[model samples]
Target: MISALTAPAPRAGNRAPRPIYVTKGGDMLNPFTPTPTDPPSYLAKYTARDTAPGLARRDAVRTLLSWGLEQLADAAELVVSELVTNVLSHTSTRTINVTLIRTGETTARIVVMDTDRTEIVLPACPGDDEEAGRGLRLVASMAVQWGVERVVTGKLIWCDLQEDR
Candidate 1:
């Protein structure tokens, strides 16, 4: 299932509020019209078992990000950290899938899928003195928009960050 939520405030009077699209399973929407030359530049898949190896998952993320636009590298790393950490902490599933797809020279989508369907709630950022919290906040701040989508056995959470045109 894919669900959408909009930001609380509107940026313009005439424009309709844009929904922050979220999905769990298969492709939620075809955001792009058919384009022949704009095939994905690189594609990489990682399973849950890959996360067991220390630093392997992080390295995979870094490697994938390296192939795409450079500007989104930091946000990609942060999102990977939070999503992977959530899987490690909240579920017994050891494997999570990460796929990087380059839709255009300046656009890419980072998807993290795990065998848990629980909705991710971005909690309020904690005070500087606090020790925990703030992962999703960082994700929300960095990604253009993100949300969870439920699948048959698990769920997929994805975020998109636009690179320079």
Candidate 2:
């Protein structure tokens, strides 16, 4: 069983971090190997019920902050809260899954996956008087990058953050 994960440093002259996984045995696991059944590398996965979206968001941010990535805690908190709540709002699934990953020494990725088949329309800028509709705005402002992907189960929204250092 894979008990832990770590992202390998980016190669020389490269800015993108290599998404690698480290097991308890200290061996590197390739997430995109020839094996089609291999799961994507992730540090943790939290499952939450539809009745408690806040709890899921809190727990995910807490887990991320605990992984020695305190520098991006605020960003993680905002992104996770927004995306998870969006999932709760969009889908009728009894439960939702939040996946946390360390993509690099100072970078982390948070993905919220739901079972809804509907396409997600990325949020656009909101007006000054708007009270809502700024979830994706917050995500865009803080995340180094953010995007949505269509998966077999449903759609997954993700955001990446990097330490200021």
The CA lDDT of each predicted structure is: 0.59, 0.66
- Model 2, residue 43: displacement in angstroms? 6.8
lDDT of 1 by residue, 6-96 (tens): 7577667765566664445432221211112245432233344434323423553555456546676666677777777766666666456
Write one digit per residue (lDDT tens) for candidate 2, span 61-162. Answer: 565555677887777777877887777766765456676777787887788777778776777678899888888878888988889899998888888889
Please provide TM-scores, in order, for all candidate models, with all chains considered together.
Answer: 0.59, 0.66
Clashing pairs in 1: 23-149, 24-149, 24-150, 48-95, 48-96
- Highest lDDT scorer: 2
How far residue 161's Cα lies from its native spot in candidate 2, in Å, is 0.8
Per-residue error (Å), model 1, residue 125:
6.0
